[model samples]
Target: MASRDDALRALEDRDWSGAEVDTSPSRPAMVVQSIRLPEDLARWVEDEAARQGTNPSVVIRGLVERAARPAGRTDVVTVRRTELELALHQAVERAIEPAA
Candidate 1:
């Protein structure tokens, strides 16, 4: 068995041929959770997930993340419109845009 000093020396002298260091960003750990929703609301979430080409869990997570953010001043909002209306307007504009 090698001593600690000897092991350190061996590692220092070891050749590095094809070692690849990971460079990807670390993600926050997540825990699985369950919640009950009204039938209509659950359907809406599923529909939204389908429209965005994502799973219902992603839709729920986005909604939860948005809700968890700190609230700002309610006096004068930049967009005084419902999210559904804003999405509908954006969809319409995208549909009307000419092809490049």
Candidate 2:
């Protein structure tokens, strides 16, 4: 993984030239951890990534971020099994709609 400074500098160079850049000191680095998922869950992550035009790592990261967000945060998500099942069913409809 790239160092935080390198990532920040790359972002600054590519996007923040005219804007005020935060020259503040960097925070402590994030810890890296490995997880072993059940095969079914791993396959679901890969499938969702394919549907969303992203990679499995991105899907897993987004899940972790949402799960870790503090309570009362406006962006916190609550998912229901029924909602997820409906969404999965709808994905099949969506997949065929464009070709019709």
Candidate 3:
């Protein structure tokens, strides 16, 4: 991690009082994380976000998610089992429906 400003560093040093971890994938909780970044890099992130027509938070999240999931992986997210079953049933019924 790059050197954070003293205030940001202090925040990081403090113990978190909220939930420590979220293990669920679907409907995962959002947590605010503080980090210090070099001024130039932070500017670049803001610039990229502007170019992409999105806010800085979206850009940052995209970077983190892309890095966390390596290339050639398809299993990012999926529908719930119940939803899948319902869709599959409808498709099967349509495909096998008899014609007069």
Candidate 4:
């Protein structure tokens, strides 16, 4: 098995083709441990992702990203209830409409 540094170097080489690399300081990789969910919970996650037209891994990643976001981050915005309702209505309409 390749070492972590070797893997990252390979990725960097593939991403950068002779471009001057940034030597700026960067944080070390934080290992995220994975867990095996119970069968029922795993099924629910998959169902929820499918219902939202996304993959389970994407749903999981989004949840993690949301949780990890720093407090008072001005970059994050909240959706109004009315906007959510309108979006839901549009989605339903699109779903029922026949393809041209």
Which run of 10 residues does model 1 get worst, by summed lDDT? Answer: 72-81
lDDT of 4 by residue, 1-100 (tens): 9999998889877746666978887765666658699999899889978766667886787788789988777694676798678669869987998999
Global lDDT scores for all candidate models: 0.81, 0.81, 0.80, 0.80
Q: What is the alpha-carbon RMSD of candidate 4 to the true structure? A: 9.5
Query: Could you tell me the lDDT of residue 95 within candidate 1?
Result: 92
How big is the positional error of residue 97 in model 1, measured in Å on the Cα after superposition? Answer: 9.2
Better by lDDT, candidate 3 or 1: 1
Per-candidate RMSD, Å: 12.3, 10.2, 16.0, 9.5
Residue runs of model 2 more than 4 Å from their true location after superposition? 1-31, 75-100
| Per-residue lDDT of model 2, residues 1-100, tens digit only | 9999998888877855567868887765677678899999999999998876668887888899879988778964677798677678777878778764
Clashes in predicted model 3: 0
Report the poorest 10 consecutive residues by lDDT, candidate 4.
26-35
Top-TM-score candidate index:
1
